[model samples]
Target: MAARVWRDPVLWLAFGFGSGLAPVAPGTFGTLPGVVLAALLGLLAPAIGVPLWAVVLLALIVLTPIGIGLCGAASRRLGVHDHGGIVFDEIVGVLIPFLLVPVTPWTLLLAFLWFRLFDVVKPWPIRWLDRHVSGGWGIMVDDLLAGVFALAAVGLSVHFWPG
Candidate 1:
């Protein structure tokens, strides 16, 4: 059966433009929309008045909850918990590493790699949250931590990378 997102526009956004519908590696694909969004915001920041960092920060703050709600609702409708195809959480998580960071291809690629690593590994408190938290929060929290981990890694890279 096709995903509800195919029939519903709202679900389409929540599911990260059907990236989450991929049979393999949905999480990775799902994160792509956030990457594109960050890149566009960064590219447009100069023309748009707001700084790239501000745009990234605002997006994470505003959209995180909405992603949570959407993921939770989708999970409920599907009768499953944290389904792979419900990856709005991945999109939200990917945004964190780019907050206040340059959105160049190099930086974005590094951040994406780190986000995926931390997301898949689920280290320490991230793993704890994954185990204890439930519902949409459950789906979102670990990825949020992964983004933070990636943020730190990306920060270090930015600092150390020489001209």
Candidate 2:
């Protein structure tokens, strides 16, 4: 028989399958892969990177329900609540940083760091939303809010620091 693909938990974890279940910081690790993916995506389309990011956002929106459902079901199977491995939240979170930003290496790095920081810190409404919310939407909402905050930070920093 052919070797099965995606059979390893490490493989799944590396792909953010368990990022959602991360005990202390699910979103933090969960979003890292997205940052890496966005950086790669940025490199492929530096000129229209922001538009490409929009495409990613659209794709994420379409996939959210499916992702949430899968993650929720998986959580039930695993006997866990929001398993850290379910990292669609991270994928969604990282896309925000590239929405309007130029796709230079520096910008990509900045976006990654900004998104990670915001995701981990979970300030203001992100924290509020995270606490109040539940279920699959809840799993992704906090990271989405964190992404918004990160995008704002990057925007302001770009506006003022323009270097």
**Most accurate candidate by lDDT:** 1
RMSD of each: 1.6, 4.7
Per-model TM-score versus the true fold: 0.92, 0.74
What's the TM for model 2? 0.74
Give the CA lDDT, 0 to 100, for residue 77 in model 1: 74
Report the C-alpha lDDT of model 1 over 1-163, residue by residue, as the tens digit: 2456798765676678888888899889988887888788778887888887788888888988887888778777778888888778888888887775878898888888888988888899998998899898888888998999999988888889821
Give me the displacement of residue 108 in model 2, in angstroms: 1.9
Candidate 1 overall lDDT versus native = 0.82
Candidate 1 versus the native: TM-score?
A: 0.92
Worst 10 residues of 2 by lDDT: 1-10
lDDT of 2 by residue, 1-163 (tens): 0111156443353337545445666666677677777776666664654466666666567766765665556555555566556677777677776777766666666777888888777788888887887776777788777778878888888888776
